[model samples]
Target: VKKIISILQAARSKTLQQWKELDCSITIVANEAKDNVRYLYTLDKYFGPLAHASPVMMEHIPSLMNTVFMIYCTSPYYNTSEHMTSLFLKITNQMINTCKTYLCEG
Candidate 1:
């Protein structure tokens, strides 16, 4: 969860930086936007701080990927790709049934 949060924060930061480079005050060439001023303020409010934290979040992807791979391997039959499709379906069904049983019992 922490890794995921970091990744999202980094992405938000990068997006903020790219947005900041634009001239928000420029008038639209094709259509005169009625809320151009409001839009500029909104853009500043949205992307300003997120740009700073982007790098820290991006640095965590490798560990996060490893964790996901580990979880995906939790299925006993995940070792081989030959039966991967069938194995995935079976695993999903088992998970669903387990959840249903637990729900009923609780």
Candidate 2:
């Protein structure tokens, strides 16, 4: 679980780096991954195994939440790809469902 947290942090860092270095020209966005939407997929892969995990860590949740927001909002995934939108919702819902306590101390 600790390792997973580390990886999510790395992914979040990478996403930020890509966003910071992004180059846009109306036709396309050129960066490290070339498509920021890919971050969602990357995060989804990890979030899958944790869907049913007990005691999900709060450390990872914020990293993924922030990274997902950055990609889904500033990138082309914003209201463009319903597929990605569904995926984003799925992953976020997974987090919210699994880590409800962290959302608010209840």
Candidate 3:
């Protein structure tokens, strides 16, 4: 899990670097690998900053949540893509609401 968080932090940094260089003209569609072992804390660490830097993060909120959900969904203990996607949306909506709250408060 520690290693997974480190990798995700790296990926998040890469995404920010790409966003800076590319100016987000292109959509970065990521692929899912089987048995992904990423950690949620790593994602949480990056989400706030990434969203702060890029307003478009709000647009792809579903994809972001899906990425995290898929990590858990791919586990051997419970392989559930449908439930993962559904939960992803639920979480995505909460994230969006949080973002909206922050935007309004600021």
Predicted model with the maximum TM-score: 2
Candidate of highest lDDT:
2
Ranked by lDDT, top first: 2, 3, 1
For all predicted structures, in order, the TM-scores are: 0.25, 0.39, 0.33
Q: Tell me the lDDT of model 3 at 68.
A: 65
Candidate 2 lDDT at 57 equals 49
Candidate 2 global CA lDDT score:
0.57
Kindly state the number of residue pairs that clash in model 2. 0
Tens-digit per-residue lDDT, 1-106, candidate 3: 3454456567776455444544333322221232232344435654664446346656666656576666665555324677467656666666677678677876
lDDT of 2 by residue, 50-92 (tens): 5654564445667776766666666653436765578667877
After superposition on all C-alphas, the RMSD of every candidate to the true structure, in Å, is 23.8, 17.1, 17.9
Candidate 3 global lDDT: 0.53
What is the Cα root-mean-square deviation between model 1 and the actual structure? Answer: 23.8
Error of 3 at 84 (Å): 0.9
Model 1, residue 27: displacement in angstroms? 74
- Number of backbone-clashing residue pairs for each candidate, in the order shown: 3, 0, 0
Could you tell me how far off, in angstroms, the CA of residue 85 lies in candidate 2 after the best superposition?
5.6
